[model samples]
Target chain A: MGRRVKVLLIGFGSVGRALAKVIALKRKIINSRYGILIDVVGVADSKGMALKAEGFDEYELLKLCEVPRSGVNLFKPYAHQGVDLNILYSNTQPDVHVELTPSEYTSGEPGLSNIMYAIDRGAHVVTANKAPLVLKYKEIVSRALSRGVRIKFRATVLGGTPFISTLTSMRSHDVERIEGILNATSNFILTEMHEKLVEFTDALKMAQALGIAEADPTLDIDGVDAAAKIVIISNILERPLKIEEINRESISRVSLRDIIDAVRQGYVIKSIASFDVRGGKASIRIAKIPRSELFAQINGVMNGVRIRSDATEVVFIGRGGGGIETAHSVLDDIVSLSFEDS
Target chain B: MLGRRLCVVKIGGSLLRDSKSYIESAQKIREVFVENGYKAIIVVSAAKGVTDKLVQVAKGSQEALRHIVEKYLEVAKELNSVKVIKRVNEELKRLEIVAGAINRSGVDLSLYDFLLSFGERISKILLVGALEATGVNALELHADELIVTNETFSDASIDYISTSANLEKLYSSIVDSPTIPVIEGFIGSTIDGRITTLGRGGSDYTATAIASLLNIDRVYLVTDVDGIMTADPDIVENAKLVRTMSYRESLEASLHGAKRINPKAFEPLEKFYSSKLIIGSWSKFGTEIVKEIPRELWGPKVIMNRASQDMSYMAIVGEGTSSVQFIRNVLEIIDRNGIEILGLQSYVHRPSLLVYVSSTYELKTLHLLHKELFEGV
Candidate 1:
């Protein structure tokens, strides 16, 4: 409550909305309970940036989102709409920057561009966009560390659930194996198909109907999204996993008959993003787990992670992808960054 | 309650309503317990109101049947525990057939009991699954298996000998196995394998019965309220919490309609059991009702009152209540104020007395008694 920490957010998308929701809901929780207040001082989209040096009002931001073609160009008073990133960063020195832009694999430019700018300004970075971490983990981490600022992307792996922190904490122990249902869209489709004995297309339709799967859902169904998360994990664990190195298998190959067969066999097929760090080399793949496997039981849009560590084998289950859930994660990073507890 | 070294936490339906809260509470519980070197075995109820709604379906409310099924399915979808949802749906289908037979053949109480037990059974299974899912090595023990009861229809009496034997057989290794064993409260069974419920607010009884039978340390009945207040909070605006009370006081207060402790919950911990029972909320700082008085306490025999729409009762419970002078002193104070007491009862077995009066005189009576008890000139 003493000092209000400023936050710079890039890419005002679904995840951006979620993070903002957490700040609004947890504003009282943070102030009364944790004695910290975080302000999203700056927010930018693909078009331009908005700057409010004092604080970017959450209500205004949410209203701006509701308006058509008006992400960074909402209000005129305190909010300087349509200002570019260079002008926004230099003018309003933020404490933390949140990168949540659209993910691009070959070139993580949009996310990397904001990340570099934020780090150069001695501001911390919290992002959910996977392209930045998957493409340039070492460079970003080193830059943030050299500047004595933190870089957290809990949303990138398992939105707002602390999977990355949990993994990093268990680094003291020998983590022999790691497995999870990281992609919620694939899991939702598979669970629907298996439970109803419906065809893959019907299940995908159901997922789309329920807003669980995206319209295209190619990255999720094709295992690209989960593979990207595995790569992030590999980089965090110091295993250095490349996107090309993973033996990726898409859930689309699973036919209606395959789903029925698995159900009859007392097994549920989940898109498992896994890594075995014990061996000299690590591998990432989407493999079928028996009914007894913990990952098999995780269904719908829920995401679960099981880390077979030296001390214990623990499971972390949560809403894998939701505007609200992931937003809470981004808010969590901001809170930890501002509060003394984390 | 494990021992002097443990804390028995009963997580009721209010807390375990969703996966996020479950995981959050689990993490917080583990953090606090692990830090203090205390082991905890949490007894979880069904996610808020799922049990009652399930019962409506079983009792042949056709209109409520589909709604009940959808609720469980929704929770299963939310918790990602569809195995439970599938099993519950199958059981519900079977229940529909049984209910039809029951409707034709006159309502069988035993069948009704079996039908009601499904809620707790499903809840226990899902909660344990969820706890395990959240990385808390938790196992589910059926209340029927752990809590043997008589063949009473709605309210069943616990058969301790058989129940203890069953619990020992099923969960002896779990004491130190570092795995939390979750059991359904309020539902148990007879020797003949007939399902029976422990009755209203029976989950607390189930938790205490297990704690006493297992001889674990403390039984924490975590409810929605902070603790037993000096008066019913809704009626008395200035009701403050009585931080520490004896089991005798809690029993008296509960008898007088204080919702903190279940009256039946105290029967199991009556004897030489050292396990203390603490009544607190999910947040913290409630009342601690112990089996015996610890030496360090310094407090008067607090007057705890509860007032409903028509009735009000004040309970004065303490070891000092045995003396005739104390009783007279309390009576004379109420009498001097010209307050008409409807009922006054004292027990020789316990150190407590209850005074039930009309709700109209509650405020005036409390003012006179407060001056007499604490602010004596």
Candidate 2:
């Protein structure tokens, strides 16, 4: 009722649905706390899009959350044919564009093009989709800057907390090194293997059963997910790194034997991602560290990061990869952007 | 008439068996509530014996898990909706994965609770499918998403404050609309989102809790039986149907081993008393129960034979049943009938009395008590 921020949403997967649920659940609180009302002007899924020029209400958003997986086109009365991002933007102009398409590291397709279209329209872009940001953070940021529009992707990396924003605020110090357990699926498997004395295959199966790991966990186990976060972190630190620039070692390399051996020596095998700012090198490896270290204590689906600079070192830790957690991150970005003077 | 009169109807597990049964139940709801200008929140239990099968699977029963997957898939196929079938298959696939993990690892209580919950969760889907197939618009509200509870794994209690807030917020938006929301019963989630079950026979508890919290006036605990009987029908051939009962009498009757009721259900009704519970079959809905019994109806409503240690006892349950006058009358009856008893125990605070007797005379005492108290002999 105070100030309304119109948004166009791209993607309707788990994260997207969770975002809708949270928005519907928090509508009154958000309006009261921030004096801002967020109205999703349009939503695009793989099948098609749904649009309303005045933006959707809580009831519509809640219904959208229940739409079958990739079945937004089935939503009646308001369901529009085709998922062309350009059509969505042109139909009803939005103040902010939120992109949540699944990460497409190689091409960042759809998301890359969708985000570029939003920026071209002079709209502030808030993206939880890591593909576009990982590929062309500088280009995206520069384009948004030139257009005098803000781009917030806090959900792209360590989104469980304000990791990127904190890093930005510490620019006054001479940055030295960064290390973290960035991938929740890999971390969960490692934790299960260590605590339960299970083999690699068993641990991964358990992770899959528990939904910590996806059906095809190649991206997570092969360290590609960690590498993506590292690339995003590197870019945030103004290092201008690319996704392919970071070397990745699969966490699968660690076996039950390795874990036992590590435990015998008061150490644990953890999938750790590191960036040496001074040397300009970054990689995610299966590293062995002493049992009492902060990274060793980071277990299950919880992610943790350690950053060191000339003045001090600090640790940040929280849940990282759940849809609801990432949805909150996306919501926070949307709300923060809504408060800024246009 | 006045803004759609509201009621809560809980379809018990006994009323759900095959796809046909689910359809029949949905039709009954449509005829009784939907078509009657009423807005009802339908709470449903797992299909008959599904929870037992899941309990076995949770205890490492290999055969039961396969039975569950086949049974649910078959029922979903019978529903004939591709969308419903797909969703049910996905849920069963997830269930299989969780079961596999539980089998690999030793059984953990938390996981066991989550495993047992598949019964209600899957049934909710099938029921929703059934409702839609019957030309009734229904929505599936997974109990995990709404029924917030304490941290107990198998016997969790609903945290009314949190659950009330959730129900008010979620249901208010749709209560005025024509579509109905069907929620799974006997299951809730911890505040942290871990699945917890409300013990067995807890579906009635779930229904009453919603009615009490939402301030609805009536709850139908739809089961296979025709309301509460004066005695166990299997034991006593002349058992009569109890037309009415006080909330306390039902609670006491259930506590003393009376058939067809769960003592756990009285918590919400006792605390709030905002709703009345009617227990019966879908065809014949009768047996009204409210917070207080009328003075004329404040007498023994049921008699049950129960065993404690090596002693068997006959329990008489009703309001004002623990008074000295009633005890004197019961003693006079035992004397008149030449029925020997070991002891009689009653608490003035509770509306029940336990009359202990030898096991040989247990049935005799129950029959005599039913004849004298319930049959008005």
Candidate 3:
């Protein structure tokens, strides 16, 4: 009621659909609960963009998500064809830009370009994509902070279930160590292999069939997905950690013999993301965890984050990476943002 | 939902697959258990279809069982847990020897249960280790240790009194602490401590038995089904979730061939305690089964059909077996329908009874019986 906040969302994938649903369904609740009005005025996809000066209809957006190709042409008087980053800044100005683009780990170009446009337009930003952060987190975070604009990415770390927020919340306490199973894809692949006795290729195929893994599951199976997650942890811990610097161990190294051997020894083989803060330096690695350890219980695509603080080693786990859960996470950020504005 | 209570979760074989959804579900379940300060006792089935494959091996030659052993070890390798990989190989070797004896000596059906038990034994070993790997305080309790049954090999009835005592002793070691107890589902031990099976989809029974016996609040049956639906989703186009159901309804629904809860599970639950049961997809909110239902808008007391009929008999299953009053009510409807009941088998361990009927009158009998018993007076 005080001031209407406008949001611009990029991409219309599953996460986008979920995000739209959350923003719409939880709007009244958010308003009464948090006392902030959020107006999603701009939405875009790979094929095109839609712009409404006041705000787009949430119901219409949800309906569009159901159709093939994601309702690119369905926003009456507001739907525009052919998406451009410039439209976010030039024609329909937005206060916050939500980046939900397809990931490009190597370059993070799509996400990077969107962030640049959002910053240039003086818009604060929230993102669920790990690509942009994996590639240029230091540069992007610094730029937004320097401009006095917030860059909230709770979804990036553990899909908005209060993971990074919880870790950062415990900043007052000494959190010297952090470890977990951060990559759902790798976990899924491994879990499938163990349960079904399916080969790696078969497990990967099953993951793709479920749409949990990308067609090219390199990032997940190769441990890059966990790497990106670890990188985020390092940054949160204020450690100068680079993707290349971290010692990576992919689940691909796990042979059929390895799994069989591990089972024989009464142990589980979990792909673990661990961090050690010592000598004022932090290092992250992917290890084959033993069943006797806490990390071993983590199965399938679940992401578990354990923080070893001065008091207790708290573990947080959930749907680590899913469009629905990630979307909910982004909604949490918006709700928090709305509260802060109030 | 917020407070920490003792909770038992039974993960179905489908959700136990080595898939991201399965692992993620496991992690989420474990997280919820820890976050709310609930002491979790997780009973896990073999990964996905591993049990069936192991059963195939158990049925075949010893060479086939050896192959099954290799297959299990391969899974440990995939996760990169060398310790478990080694231990499972040795255990499988012993199982392989048993398989050899079964094939060489007369293959006793009881041996099938013993040989097939390895699948879940290996699974518990893997799951507990996996939990520990994630920094969750998890311990493995061999299924046979806590789940006590009679000498019946394949479909053994549980020794509830003994099982409860064993559970108490085991819980004494870890209860009130953060340690999670991982157990093998569907497998129990004879009074003499030999391996036995509760039956297919029987792991849920084990979980329910433990949950109810321990007076836990709820038993989470994490399965492939999203929740209890009006009909099998594959068959009914308009099938939607029945979000909240009574224990009676759940027993009826599942016994009438609902994809989630095993009918046998209702026995231990109904007898010792009426714990809440939530059966659903591995990582999603599911239908909650309460002990009692308000009759306001609820439809029917039971739903039954001959899921499968042969020349020999009909299978009439649902909740309320021990309730002779309820049983009499159902039989009256069947009698009024003029259906010929060939054989009726009821388990003291559960609230389900299977009635064998002549195949010729099966359809007519079920149709009339559905209206009389399910749509009820």
Candidate 4:
């Protein structure tokens, strides 16, 4: 039998659900392969929370996924509705607190508070929300360190592609720069404009229609999403920078004519987010990279990050927007945390 | 189960475009049914452009496949519910498997229909999520589990007997529960368990079929447009909303490209029960399609226009328009004006007549028909 790790998931949104589903669907394989049996003891959403002292079974986890607002209904045998996170933590006493709340960059509330509270209570924290880290990375990390609790946020940047993890593992090598297409939505819209010869607005509409972009796409189109990722990356590289310091340029002004003209000139317009680690600078802008470049080849809702280090320039390309992939990354982080503790 | 007051609401794809609408829909459902002490069954289409993207995925567009998955994820994110988001991911995974099979094996209609079913399947989860977010206890009821059909794949006709039995059983199981059941409209499954779709605009058919089976009094078809209009509002600036019309009138209008209601949607209602069908948007009630129209309200309920590059016509739809006297009078007027009628079609059973003429004469024909059919009334 593998080691048992009890998890309490907050914010039952796409990423959270994806993690639950992944745990349910790949329970046996994950347990056998990683020697860890994850037990989700508590789940909470905006409306209510569900707690089980004995931890939830695979069937319970799946049933939780089918419920409407909260997993509270799934705990009908011992139903407690409208329970807050405080009650959940005290009752369930989870080993790891999984924070999947929506990013609130201004104050990082809910996620920030949730992370701090979990760490204060002596539980490891794994987060997919980037807002808290973007706003107060140092404070959170220092708090986690002081408390001797591991805080893993592998799904925060690049939709859980292990970009940060890879960067962290390469600590021995002095990386000169880090740059690539960080925002999948912006990259997808730019690709659509160039390939379909449509106006920027039309490209955005297509992206929105396809679910590649958010309803309020200002964060992505205006370079804020990528900038946030850059900020996180800068923090990871030990070159912490504020989002306000990044030179940002939105993709909104990249018109159809611009795309067509660029295409004719053997160049492709990519919404590139780059961090010059040595200079301690970050910027997100629409760059006309040559068609032959690897960055230009990365299209649609796929993210690519190129790491230029003293050893080599390595690129990681993967699906950048969907919840399943992100959830998988979160799970990976959870497993890695479990291994570290062991 | 028999005495429970229930109404089926079919929400169109256009309404699922934004997050506000989902909340608004939940609020509306709460107001119209939950608060009023009625059980509501919601039938939803994929968010706008989801089905198209799924179809493209079936055609082996990897981009479309990504889009389909992301669209549901995006909706799940907006709803911000973990259960729904997880369910959406599970459904998308199944859809991706089906898509992968289709891409490898070329085009198979059955597989394609199965692929398309994911749109409504995912939409149902999102809607239920939103409804629950709004404090409504909602459960997703997959139509395939309730509605049984033949193996016709894309446009399968419902096997009414089995479907009615399944629906009744399903209702009986959840009769005591307070939760609202949300269903995918355009998709179903065969008795043998193969996935199927009811074709385009089939969501309307799904609602009507369920209403007929349950013997519900009214089924609301909520769409982006107000309802069946006097004409396509783009062409006729003064086009008014059709407040009430007979099912036959609606059917006729639909056949002539009204597109407000699916032609097949009237079949189950016309045959089995006398359910009142209401079509409208969220803000206003638009049209009521009843089993019968009163004799006093029988003439020119709606004026529908159809135009092509070379040919065009104005269709006058009303119970009175099917009368011999009305058609004769219309022909006489056309003769008196020496207007060329390229083609004309009328049936005694259908309460509408199409007068096709040259494309140039479309507006003139509309004015002439309006003068004769609507001016005095």
Question: Against the true structure, whose TM-score is highest?
Answer: 2
Q: Residue by residue across A5-107, what tens digits does model 2's lDDT show?
A: 8888899988898888778778667888889888888998888899988878776787676666777776666888788777787888899999998888888
TM-scores for every candidate against the unseen true structure: 0.48, 0.91, 0.51, 0.55
* Residue range B1-377, candidate 2, lDDT tens digits: 22438888999998888868888998998899989978888999988889999988877787998888888888889888866787788878888888888887675566788888889888888888888788887877768878899998899999988998898777755655567789988999987667899987888889999888888889999988888888898999889888999888888887776656668788988887558888899778669988887799888888888898888888888887799999998999888989889999999999998899999888888888888887775
Query: Candidate 2's error at A39, in angstroms?
Result: 2.8
User: CA lDDT of each candidate?
Assistant: 0.70, 0.85, 0.70, 0.82
lDDT for position A287 in model 1: 61
Best by DockQ: 2
Tens-place lDDT per residue, model 1, A1-342, is: 546777877887767765654564356457667767777777777666667787755444433343223335543444455647778777778888888887888898778887988898888888888998998999999998898888888888888488888888875888878788888888888887776677777667555533467668888888888888888888888878888777778888888877777778887777777788776243334466788977888887788988887889988998788776788788877778776424
The worst-scoring run of ten residues by lDDT in candidate 1 chain B lies at: B98-107
Model 4 DockQ (Cα-based): 0.04
Model 3 per-residue lDDT tens digits across residues B1-377: 12347788887777665634334654776677667677778888877766677677656654556556666676666555545566566567657656554543344555578778888888776676566556675666767656899887788889999998877755653454456778899999876445799988888889989888888888888777787654434533444566777776676656656556678888887898888888787557567888876655354333344545454433444344545675676578788767778777666455566667777766666556554544333
Which residue runs of candidate 3 sit more than 4 Å off their true CA positions? Answer: A1-3, A69-77, A279-288, A309-312, B1-377
- Candidate 1 vs candidate 4: the DockQ winner is 4
> What is the full ranking by TM-score, best candidate first?
2, 4, 3, 1
**Candidate 4: residue A296 Cα off by (Å):** 53
Clashing pairs in 1: A18-A327, A19-A327, A160-A329, B1-B8, B1-B217
lDDT (10s digit) by residue, model 4, range A174-235: 89899999887898888877766778877776565444676688988998888988888888
Off by over 4 Å in 1: A1-342, B1-7, B16-21, B34-37, B81-102, B294-313, B335-344, B347-350, B356-359, B367-377
lDDT, residue B178, candidate 2? 69
Q: Cα deviation in Å at residue A15, candidate 3?
A: 1.4
On a 0 to 100 scale, what is the lDDT of residue B347 in model 3?
63
